[model samples]
Target: MRIIGRALAAMVLLVTAAVAGAVEEDGYELWMRYRPLDKAAQSALQPRATALVYSGTASPTAQAAISELQRGFGGMLGKVPAADTQLRNGAIVLATPASMPELAKGLEALGSEGYQLRSTVVQGKKLTVIAANSDKGLLYGAFALLRAVGTGAKLDALNTSSAPKLQLRLLNHWDNLDRTVERGYAGESIWDWWRLPDIRDRRYTDYARANASLGINGTVLNNVNSKPEILTAPWIAKAAAVADVLRPYGIKVYLSARWSTPLELKETKTADPLAPEVAEWWTRKADEIYRAIPDFGGFLVKANSEGQPGPQDYHRSHADGANMLARAVAPYKGIVMWRAFVYAHEKPVDRARQAYDEFKPLDGTFLPNVMVQVKNGAIDFQPREPFHPLFGAMPKTPLMMEFQITKEYLGFSTHMAYLGAMYEETLREDTQQKPGGFTVAQVLEDKDHGQRLTGMAGVANIGSERNWSGSHFDQANWYAYGRLAWDPQASARELAREWAAQTFTPDPRVTGPVVDMMMLSREAVVNYMTPIGLHHLMGTGHHHGPAPWVDSLGRPDWNPVYYHKADRQGVGFDRTATGSDALAQYAAPIARQYADPRTTPAKYLLWFHHLPWDYAMPSGRTLWAEMIAHYDQGVGEAKDLRARWEKLKPFIDARRHEDTANLLDVQVKEAQWWRDACIAYFQSVSGKALPQGVKAPARTLDYYKSLHFPYAPGRG
Candidate 1:
């Protein structure tokens, strides 16, 4: 019995050791995934990162840089370099002019936030210097240097400097006070509202670390469809606690202020922008907030669009409302981001035209601290949208681009629809803000906006899921948004490549195929869901799946049919002269290009004009036939994505590979559903037979219409 017991103890010890030493990776690290490299890569890197010589006592941001470099080195090379006080062989120095003046020459040109990394031979040893104007720059430089090393950039010839193209890069969370996230497909909100200033989760620091790693500087907490109570004293303390965690990472916290706060709080009878009491109440509120969080980034307002109260209620313009709040925060150097996604409650002459019409006239009337935040497209975040007409039209107003990083209309988290392509497409558009001049990206970098701030905001798609974003690939969108926000003109394909290299492996063999698939992912979604300019064809309230036939909503714009008017004569909404004439909202050149089908880009042909089923396409096929080809191609792409990822199984771990594979299986099925249901509906309306060699939908139109999701994910 004694011999058996001793043997059992030995077996238990062996099991415990095995469990402790096992190599397992859940995707919580995201693109910062710095698992140890293989023998060769680690062997090449370990000697170069032998010592980190960051002079003087480190500031919080510098300390952050030091910690990150250590983490990266330890993880990737299995070597955490010693923090040496003096320079030595292959020593990497994180420095500013005040800290190490010898290494800071030519760094003055790098600006406050910009950084430079240079490799020089000092005496006989290699010295890599990361020099900057400030501690923030040193931190950014640290990330750049590590990223290059991780991606296998040659260390010998390294010389690089980069500054943010936009002044403010922010992430907007749509988390409600109740902890439910609107349009969030991930799990519950990460912000635990129940836990106050008392219990600050370690996840808060992790969140800040992630954002700082990507050059993101601000986060707007709470939903745009906000609750009034968030502005109360208790909530202010809770927000301050979060701000405390993020401040070290150089991130300022902003809040979505419900415009009707005073009214709901009974601090005032009416929340009119022009009313003295209302203005005073807001001023006091801003002061209180600033007192708690001295570096508080200001308000994000969503008003008068979707039943949200606004200054328009008191017959004042949007500028009036924005200016009123802008005044309140401007004293503390804070700015207000007023959303331009609006229309009257009644059906508009064209819902797409409403925002442009309203804001265009009041462009110069806004306060210096107020910026109008415009969506990337005229409509909501469709699978594809012509760049929003407002991008170039409102040059007098400080216009900030708002991209949805969350896949709200693009199959939520289930489908792999990379958004890097979508972001690049809109940013690169020739906005024609000046004749023979600015692209949409250039317009954002305009220095003439005076005291008006230039910035970009992304609707954050994050949650309490262990991986942060629900799916693994959704992490790419978050990473892409941050990278592009730093430099809007940065190539999405290159970012995809870099992301794949760092997140998976620096191995080009793994990265090359991943880049190809991601580059095509967004277009694949557009093909299946809204090919040829068809938009807003998803289910009504939840927007879960196909519902092109839906037309019973109270407001015309709420119904999908209003966007795509399919009939016996033609299909697609006509924005040309004969219909809404919404094209007139664009520049004359753009209007002319889209005036006739002959000049319009084939991708957007159906969006701006309605054409008969037999109309000849540029491909020498009938419009009906071409549409079928796109839908079929989309289905093929979905299947191809699955097969391609399957081959990558040998490279990726079982956990992430399996998660993606299962989702791809669902995506392929749903892509077919989108293709079939849309084809069925279009056929019913157009009275056109399936083109020769085209497969007819497997089910009747009634079968699809009967498929309903009374309860779907998101929209909490």
Candidate 2:
């Protein structure tokens, strides 16, 4: 036993050393790396920093803020600031306005959760004041300052005040308890639940640090298809340990609750929302969880969706179920995030319209503490999708936008598709509701209409991979999600530049081409996979490759044929008044715009209307010709991405550069595969010969249809 124990101790030591060593070597450190700045940047930053003085009491958050400042300063300038009670020359002071009363006067406009950073003199000493209304705000301000330093910004005359536009900026980890992540391309789940409660991994702390730096304050740690066992005593204890680690970073931990937990775990007769026993059980469970972790965020429930149990099983409304959970947690100031992604197979309506039909009626009925989380698009995370109808339809309910950061539909990290542009495109789209200008972001921010608490949630792609997110470029998606969550109006191009500069280097040559590649990456993937709003046309189950010919699934909604509706006459699902009338779900002005394919953006042409194959497009080409052109263009772009990456070989690390280069090779081949497979299948249905200059597919349509992938990753 002693020999075994010693061996384990040695293993632990070696692992710790390896992790610490990776801080310098691995790109997985993400944007948190406080590497020393260039000589010019160092000279510019050092003159403004002499000492660090934090006025607040030594709480965990305060300490973390100070530690981050020290780490950033020590690495960036080769100088660690001395922590002192009084400000000195060139000192940086961090404090909440309440902690330093005199400083409160100037920071009044920073708001309750906003932060202010200003250069000022204190008692004949020059100092940089980092002041906020709360400790969490102060910590966020510190991180912002560190980020500016890392990005080679001038700090001498800095005066910046910022706050999150959205209330709940969160990352929903689709991680199961058994360590397999749903749609996670990186690896197994990062949550080492087996060793938790007693032994916490340092990675958890770093994860919190990365999230907090981006102003993300909440995380749901489990998959939405929850397991009842997560509510057990052992799992609750494990969650508490993680909460303890994250508390300092101001990130509240949340869990996805299994709706039938009372029945599954406690041997109850029924899990009815109106039942006294079920209500009491949930209340007691909430009490138990709050007692273990004082600031437990709340629950994320995906009930009655894709086989999940819910109040509907007992002939009750969604509001009934959500209100029940809300009442249970309201006493503890916790909110319930009830998903709006519900659908029933029994319903004979369009799958895209189901969520809107179900939730629109329950708009004003939900409790204030309950938020109905809606996906960015009406359908599942497609390569491209029109903004969800619920974005503007729910005027009385607070809706949280849920975006999938994991590449479920966009080629799963193997293809470089930057989603920041996609997110921004969705948010900035004019819903055209009300008289004045109104966007999806405005719909979220319009608190007067009872859309009080706005939130943005990204399904996390992070796992235990050495590079954090499977591929080097994949890290940019995580970064982009956080930046947009903080400020939805942020430019995707600018965010890509910031990430590239910090992650790779600040060289214009390196960042310029990389950002260019990233900005167009998403469109390229869409072109190859589902251009012009074609969606869910991937291979069954795995969703890794193209299988546009798949039509034999069990249910109509489960089949790709139902979504594309490609036939001899035309292609695309008709959601306008002529078909399902799904377009009417949006506000009138926006609906009118999409009602006509001629006026609707070409990017979403097929999504809104089913057009003839030979219909004229804005590009002076027929729809079929345009489709062929897009596929050919996508293939060319993938080839260009490979060549551009080849040019960057000298600038990037050999390992990462080569890795990305090889992936681009796969991407190019797959792009051709998608083009050929889709063209062949569509041609077979339309019976149209290939347009001039568009080469015939090397393989027959039957060959593409016969392909199988039983062992594909992310198939659950």
Candidate 3:
């Protein structure tokens, strides 16, 4: 009778807790969750971390470091360690040479943003010291310390030194004035433009913390397709309000300014770069912005590209447009990020060749502060594309890497495609520009190129969703981008492992399966969606699902048929000597290899050279057979990924675990859909039969084409 009463009491307690909403972890905590550690491990490490000491002036950035450390320790260890000015045994000390003269000599090696963290006995006191040249570096060091502990690094034996490889690491938000995000899948834009100047959201603080944790320093707050009002007086005040919050975290706010802003705002008759009134208007605008936000990072302009106005509208070159804005901001130490994505689809030539054709000849003409932002590939962010020819081609101008993090071409936020592997592939590709002298990274770092500044930008996937990014896994891509931007040479696999450990659990069993799933994710998306060099085969408008059969769009570039060129005689676009000769745009070695279908790497075979359906591949299978096999392989990978996530249920929290499990289920279903939809359309165009062992597509081409998502998220 007593035992039954006890059981009944426990059941009541459980029900009451559920009714009151016992903590359900939505992923708003990102990698900085700092959740409580396992009791046994916490007990073991507690003695080694008995004290915390900071001997520096309490600058806002330095205080941020102290506060973050306290929060991390409190959550992870179940108690905040003692804080003091004097170092003690087992103390974790943060100091700059300016504060601690004893640490001054060693800190000279670490640059302004660099820091050295080491464990040693100082004055007979065994301690861990994070010494840097400045307080900003101390804040970065603090985050690094928390990251190490969260990822299971031993604090007692810590020894590490680090600095950023790139000077500018930025997130380009495609958020519009109306809070509608272009290509954003998570939710509405996080920026509440209507209430910014008066009401600062706490989410803004969390956003700054997240970026600082990863060493990201800049953010462009609006879409490249920007409205002129963003540059007006009202918006400048709002920007200042947000900037004040982010300043202490070491992040600067940038804006995407319209090239025709002066005209659009009715401040000038024309926006021609050479026009004196237009030049005066931009100069005044820069002055106004700088006066409000003293450290405002300048404009990101998308010009005569996509019908946006530019110098070209008045018969001037891209250099003229970029330089005019550069001069205006030069007085205030701001930059102009001029996009190199301009292309004319009206031209019959290959779309891949157009950017280089327009910008190559005027390479040396851009001003020092003008960074020509080039997309990772010559074509838009496809599933797979060769590195852009412009990377090492234009040595005289500074070029910034623009990688899209929104997954616009890779099935948005629903699909589980990790982009770390994709970034590593492009960053490592050898440009072979001058007799083995340069890689893509090397070109940007080169002093001879007159590159006073170098940077990388990612199109942000962040939104108002509780998880930050739409899916739990999509957060990994955002984390990966910031880490890569800080150090271009870092390994994606290592980044994935660290992120998996910090984000989910440090347990080998949980992290092992997660990392394995992430490593192969992007390849699986490529296999099912485009396979071996096919590009941009999604729906005409929303870019959701497949519609490779669509032929009648306004412009040829907007149609999938124009890209793939699948026909009864052959399949694949011919960019070789016989067709558009786009291969010639690359250096001699690359051009020579891609000139022939047989010589090109099988992964990029169809991209550079078109081939017949019956052409034999190195895999000892016919081209049609190989493509079908790839599609089948991708579907299998998706199923495997879903199964792998199920194994993590024992380790992950119930809420996050279930969310990821459901998303993975969607990924598997979509993978099959992508495979079937693409295969059906190609078969119709090529008039080919499936290989003997390969299964037929699940539906007809017309049925797949009939699947429309006119109301898909992120179609603003």
lDDT of 3 by residue, 47-67 (tens): 656777887468888888888
Per-residue lDDT of 1-716 in model 1, one digit per residue for the tens?
99999999999999987764454457888877777878987776666788899889998988898899999888888779889879898888887889988888787556788899888877788888889999898888888887898788867788888988788899999998888899998899989989968988888888898898789999998999988989999999999999998998889999999999999998899988999999999999999999999999999999999888998889999999999999999999999999999986475688888888888899789988888999999889999899988887777788889999999999999999999999999999996657786788977876665435788999999998998888989999999999999999999999998889888888877899888989988889888999988899999989988999999988899999999888898888899899999899888888988999989998888889999988999899999989989999999999999999999988887788899999999999999999999999999998889988888998999999999897787878
- lDDT score for candidate 1 against the true structure: 0.89
TM-score, candidate 3, is: 0.97
* Model 1 lDDT-worst window of ten: 17-26
Candidate 2 TM-score to native: 0.95
Candidate 3, position 176, lDDT:
92
| Model 2, position 624: C-alpha lDDT score | 89
> All candidates: CA RMSD in angstroms?
2.2, 5.4, 2.0
Comparing 1 and 3 by lDDT, which wins? 1
Candidate 3 displacement at residue 516 in angstroms: 0.2
Model 3 per-residue lDDT at 492: 96
* CA lDDT, every model vs. true structure: 0.89, 0.87, 0.88
User: How many clashes does the backbone of model 1 have?
Assistant: 0
Model 3 spans with C-alpha error above 4 angstroms: 1-12, 15-24, 447-451
As for TM-score, the candidate ahead, 1 or 2, is 1
